[model samples]
Target chain A: MTVRSGAAARSGARGRPGAGGRPGGVARLVVRTVSEVCVTAGTLIVLFVVYVLFWTGVRADSAMDGEIGKLQDQWSTGPVAAGTPGATGGQPSGPGKQPPYENGKSFAVMYIPRFGADWSKPVLEGTAVDVLKKGLGHYGRTARLGETGNFAVAGHRRTYGDPFKDFPRLRPGDAVVLTDGTTWFTYRIDRRPYRTLPTDIGVIDPVPRESGYSGPGRYLTLTTCEPEWGHSHRLIAWAHLDSTQPVERGRPSALTG
Target chain B: MYGWIWRHLPGNAWVKALVSLVLVLAIVYVLFQYVFPWAEPLLPFNDVTVDRGMGAVR
Candidate 1:
């Protein structure tokens, strides 16, 4: 009888508690389930908020791009108005010149369709302040757009919500469309990662590491802060210009007049 | 009356704590995910347009 009683007590302890049965156990379960639901809901809410904030930043950036796009369009098609002067050339430098940037800070804006409309930013002339503020900047001596040389463009990777948000996704053979849209230039990704300092002026040199030039095959280099804000290295995406297409105003394919 | 009182009370301390956490989380989730979006546009800078051209030097 004693042994039977001990077994019965042990059975009750194991059955109701260990086996997940009992009114109190049900109550505990209800609490746990509700807690889990709350945590999951909270996590989702935070994620959604983050997504919304990113969307807002994207919109603001797009608005800025729109204004710059207008100016680029005018400069691309509109006449250089016959021999415009330097920084003093009230007339547009007409393409290869230091893009008509304000304050000695000329910039070329590169827009990639696959990267989204807002991916556009001022290409600063040599990673300077004035240029970074406006957009991605072109290396001063790198091959000018349309020229058969290495055209290097650099931008911030993390700050300002990471302008190159989708850059890491670019694959070889991906089409990178750069336009003032009048002079549409396409570059195919070719090179792998190359690390260099802000002052490594030679990295953007026209001659690309002895890659025998096919008569200055138009090349492109994209530089951004590496590993995010830490900037311990520079991420470079290199490509060769595949083709160019001209946009006629009021045309169906042109982004604008 | 006694049974009703017991029903209203949580089964244990852990259950009470869990219920409290759940309630708090639900309130936070509703406020941020649903309510905040509706309220964001009302903020002054929320829609304030930034004129980038303003920084362009003549």
Candidate 2:
């Protein structure tokens, strides 16, 4: 009986070690748990980066396409007829008489031939996050299209399809073409890209003091985040009214060239 | 830590494994949905923009 009891005690001792109550065993377990947590955190960060860089672009492209389709449908219904007041050979309408554009609504398409032959994006009203997610967003209180003030627009430089990723490539004399289903307004790039602070609302002023223009005139301001992947500052390109042509006149030489 | 959990858990190895998986999943979900979002502002991701006045400077 003594021998049998000793055997039982030995078995109990073995089982206790396997139960992980020993100090070394606990330490190993703690290390393993911490490693697992680190692995999980790393994976989550990678997933977030993928969502921000790729998934957001996919979503924005689809949204912009849909907005463009709607705008084209509206234009095709009856507004494109020749001799319409707004469609009359791209003449700039009087101040405050341009076609009404609703906030958060897409009203035009912007094409940058210098960016790419097929580089086109919808221009929506308002610079809000939601509006920008769809495509280029117009500063709400800025000048209307082809107006005698700064028709300022903003787009993301690195995400949401990165509509202005090639903004730095723009040079003086490059054309920034905009169309509102009736008239094609072409603005000649007048100033190279320059950096500015985010709070510089004057960049979109009727007469952008920074553009070296002391008097009010027709202007266009294209703004985007600088440093490609960072928004620490804004990169702006200024343009002046070059010409206007009706859509019925076919694609402009700036677009075709 | 795992050994203590293993000894305290009821049932067989399968039960312990299932319980551990559930615990891990709950921890991950809480960290992602609550902890990470709450900690975002403390990070530098959204610190890109500066609110200084508009001056044309690089």
Candidate 3:
């Protein structure tokens, strides 16, 4: 909003040079160019902030919704062959079974009542950068839905639809439900989110020592960046499988409620 | 700098204004569509993964 910037500066510069003659022209032009450059850089930085804080959310909302819709369409057309290629036709969560979902492809949808009744995000197979841009990502090496060991998932805490934006709102008994077209798996949180360094990979181990579980059991790990918009640390939450029901038996009460 | 561009914009006041607006919008579009997407991965906001690939554990 400076009066001496932008289009207005042209006339000002032309007239102002008359006061000092040609000697001031070169210095005036240099100062003007430097100021213009500074202003343009400032504008770009502000635009980048807008793109990160707002435009990204806009793009990610649609991307996540598109992924969810694609999964639903695939599930409706061919429930068995849609995902879990080898473990088709029957329940895919057979204790030791690993529902080897296609990498970068969404295989399930997760719903957290603590976030909101309508809050749901597709769970992709891998945690790679592009994969998470669509929605939540299932840690490839972790347990599959309702299976033994740790069924861990990761999601954005700030952008990319902010699937776990309210991750800290989770309570000890809050329900985290997910479905893989054939069954609904509900897990209850063991505690609120625990803040830790980004290097704490053991929090997703089969028997996470920090999760209060002394033995191996069906566990769920949710991870996101700490400090909301900062990734200097991570926020983790552990849950244990509470129950499972066939998809035909209707959605688990955890979701319907 | 902007003053020079405005002087050479070759139009009436209204047309020059329209052209300037379009140019600015085009630059923003490219930034949002191409530049921002490419730069996002370089930022820390999207680092949700536990970095198991780094072999850094605590």
Q: Fraction of native Cα contacts kept in each candidate?
A: 0.00, 0.18, 0.78
Candidate 3 similarity to native, TM-score:
0.86
- Models 1 onward score TM values of 0.49, 0.76, 0.86
Can you list each candidate's DockQ? 0.05, 0.16, 0.67
lDDT of 3 by residue, A1-257 (tens): 77557668787677776776866888889999999999999999999989888887898889989988998888788736433412232333554444377899888999999899999988898888888888998887777776668888989998777788888888899999888887778889999899998888889898985888998787899999988988899999999988877776899899877
Judging by DockQ, tell me the better candidate of 1 and 2. 2
> What is the fnat score of candidate 1?
0.00
Per-residue alpha-carbon lDDT of candidate 2 for residues A142-234, written as tens digits (9 for 90 to 100): 788877788888887776787888899999999999998888888899878989877776787889868988787779998887777665678
Candidate closer to the true structure by DockQ (higher is better), 1 or 3: 3
Would you list the C-alpha lDDT of every candidate in the order shown?
0.55, 0.77, 0.83
Collision count for each candidate, in order: 10, 0, 0
Clashing pairs in 2: none
Docking verdict class for candidate 1: incorrect
lDDT of 1 by residue, A147-215 (tens): 656777766554333567566777777666665534556667765555554444444556655333444
